[model samples]
Structure formats: C-alpha cells, structure tokens
Target: MEWGPTGAAAVPADYAVVVDVLSFTTTLSVALERGIEVFPFRWRDARAAEHAMRHGATLAVGRFEAMSRGDARHVSLSPASLSEVEGIQRLVLPSPNGSTIAFALADSGAQVVGACLRNAGAVARWLAPRVADGASVVVVPAGERWHDDTLRPAVEDLWGAGAVLDALLDALGGEDEVTSPEARMAVAAWRAARLPDDLLRCAGGVELTDVGFVADVEIAAQHDVSEVVPVLVGESFRDATEVQPAAPKLRRVDG
Candidate 1:
C-alpha cells in the first residue's frame, strides 16, 4: 500500500488498485454500473473540454461547480450526483489524485483496477485468481492535495485502500504470499474502521458534507455495494466481467 504519485512511482507492481473514495474511483464505479465508459483525465486540465468534445463525451466538473451552474446536466466527481445521469455513452472524468495515478500506472504496463469502498470486494474477487497465480499487486491510496500542491494523506483514501487490501487478504487467506508491512498496516486500519459513522466524521467526509455534498459521503460509505470492477482499457474503463469470454481484457485522455 502506498500514497499518492510519488509512492506509486516507487512501487510498480503487476496490478494496481487505485483508490480515491470521495471521488474518482467511486464515481467511476457508479458510472460503470450505468454502462458509461469513463475516461480519466487530469483534474482542472483545460484540454479536458477539447478532449470531451473531440470524442463526443461528457466532461465532468466539480460537484459545487456543477451545482452552482444551475443547469440540469448531471455528472461530477461526486458518485451520488451521477445517480440520475442518463444517455451518456462516455464521460471524461478528471481528478488530481486517482486519475493521475491511474494514467501513470497504465503507462508503466501495470494492469490498473479502480477500487473504492463501493467496489473493494468486487476488485478483490477479480484480483484473487491472478494474485494466487503469483501476480504482484499494489493498493494506492490517492491522497488529497494541500493548498500548496502537496499530498494531504486523507484518511478517506486510506480507509478505501485499506478496505481493498483487507478484502484481498481475506480472499487470499492462508496463502504465504509476501505482504508488505504497509499493506498489513492498511489492512489493520480497515479492521479498526467504524464504517459509515467513522467515515462521516473523517476529514474528507466532513469536507464534502460541509460543501452540501453529504449525500456523496453517505454513498461512499456503502461498502461493497457495487460489483462492477472497473478495469482501465485503452483510453477508458470498462467492466472486464461484462466483456465476452473471447474478447480481450481490460487510459489516456484521448477517445
């Protein structure tokens, strides 16, 4: 288990579980469940609009920004906001944490899997077979950014990463696979977490709720409620399980 891009760069495993619980990965899971192919982009990238237009995909903005726009168009980093979105075949979802790490990992030849509290178990289930076959895996907790553009190490992401690690360990129980101390620490954090209640009080959760996105916080706390395992394929994330048995498996900003 590691935090942010720097840590991610230091550990390039065969499989990477990208976690950004308050947004990104969680939102990706929700969109995947709706059949919307998601393209991860850098947060606040001015080129995102151009990329979206070029590919005829919707570009997501911040939750508060979208809400203040007073338009009916739905979609944002907030998972709950996408609940009512429809007819969007594709989306250009941007984020500084999860999306950045995902694209970086993809370029490094690592199989990228988007994981959040919502779909941790599903991701673990998807990874079990491959891991048992001796594949390496790393759970990356994409921490929040500070005002100075530094890593904030949000507890929300830690919990999300922990959730995935714990599930993976459970799925691989009794295996003598070498698990790192950091991975063990994350699993311990998950074991000690108090669920929705604790999540609600965490810094990340408070930040979202204070901005009137309490629903998003509540949605993120719904652990393992999703079965969609988002696998980054080509320039988008699609459900590998939904792919035909014969088809190739499962992200640049390009279409």
Candidate 2:
C-alpha cells in the first residue's frame, strides 16, 4: 500500500517501508549506518525528551543548534550532520511527518523500516525474504506539510518510495503478485525520475538548496549508496543486519 503521511493509519501491510527523502529517513539511514540507535519521535517537545529518556536515548536538537557546535557532535535531523558523526549509542529523531507516520505505524503492529534513495535496494533485498508469499508490503511517503497542515505530496519522497518499490518488485520477480495501484504508479514515477540530477531539480531539492542544505539534498539523492537497513525494533532503530532471525512460529496441537 502507498499513501502520504495523513494515510498512515490506513496501512494494512505486515511489513512497512517509510520514506522521507527530504531528511528524516535519509538521516536515519545515515545514522543507523554509523551504529547509532535512532528513536523516532513525532515532535521536538517535552514529551520527546521523556520518550527518549524512557528508551535511554538522547534527544536530538534542532539543526541550527546542532550546527553551532564547534565539534558538531550533536545529532539532528540533517542527513549531512549525521553522516559525519559516530559513537552515539542512542538518538531521538523528531520529524513532523516521517516520525509521526512511523509512530502511528508502530502502534499498528507492523514491522517498520525506514527507506530512502540511499538504501532502497538494500532495504528491498532485506525485506524480500521476510515477506510471506502474497503478503502485502506497504510504502508510506512522508510528504511535506502544506500551509493548512495537510499533507503536500513531495516529489523527492515519491521518488524515494518508488526506488524502494521498484527494488522490491524486482526482488519479488514482478508486480503480478502485488495489489496496490499507488505502488505501481510510484515505481513508474521513480523510473521516470532518474537519480542525482533529477532529484536536485525537484521542488523539495530546490527548497533545501535555497535553505542552504544543498549537501543534505545531494546526500539524499544518491541512489543505492548505503547498505544499512534501519528497522524499528522495540523503542529504537537497530541495524537489521545485527538483529537475530525470528524463530519460526509453531502450530498449536488441536485438542
């Protein structure tokens, strides 16, 4: 299934991929690759700190705050910032769209993973074996916010989700076994929008560039550059590669 941030509750798949290309999931992919456990939060608030403490995680500050430090050790939502840092045991990553959608999905009992253009192929390959034959895999794009606080579907996110969908479909052989129309369209859109150059010209990319986050946009646009698949487990995201394989479910004997 494919939907914007607002349709998070509508996801019905047991395995889910959340794509937020502008920053959230992209930063998360970078952070996870560095061995830091990321705890997603819906907002940067008092509750965010509380949630972080409960999970033994440190609350990430705003980008400005993170950038001001001489050593730049803080973890913020910026993918560029997270890419250079290391040795953080836990971090609370807050985002209005991506983290909110992730929080919602966590409550719905799906095994959630963050995906971006950087790691779509790796995530697809990682998830393919876990998906039961014929089971659905939902892809939720964390779009930007409109003036009225509604979801404004973002081109970058669409491409990011598409990259993951395209890889997963290829992994599964074809879309013949899948059911979502949005998923098909997402893959087509991704195919139409080539990486790097196309992404740099997109609306989201333009916005980021204007705001002086050109590096973040550049980093987010890199396709299949990362192999780390960040899976949400318990209260934080750990490297899916390090997670122990799930034990097979045993059938109960009939009385």
TM-scores for all candidates: the values are 0.92, 0.91
Pick by TM-score: which candidate is best? 1
Model 2 clash tally?
A: 0
Report the lDDT tens digits of candidate 2 across residue range 1-255: 566655766756667789999899998988888888889989999999899889888788887788687456677888998878766778999999888888778766677889999999999998777654444577898888889987788988888888898898788788763447887888889999976888789888888788788899999988998999988887678788889534323222233
Candidate 2: what lDDT? 0.82
Tens digit of per-residue lDDT, candidate 1, span 68-136? 886646578888878778778899998998998887787777788899999999999988888877678
Best by lDDT: 1
Counted clashes in each candidate structure = 0, 0
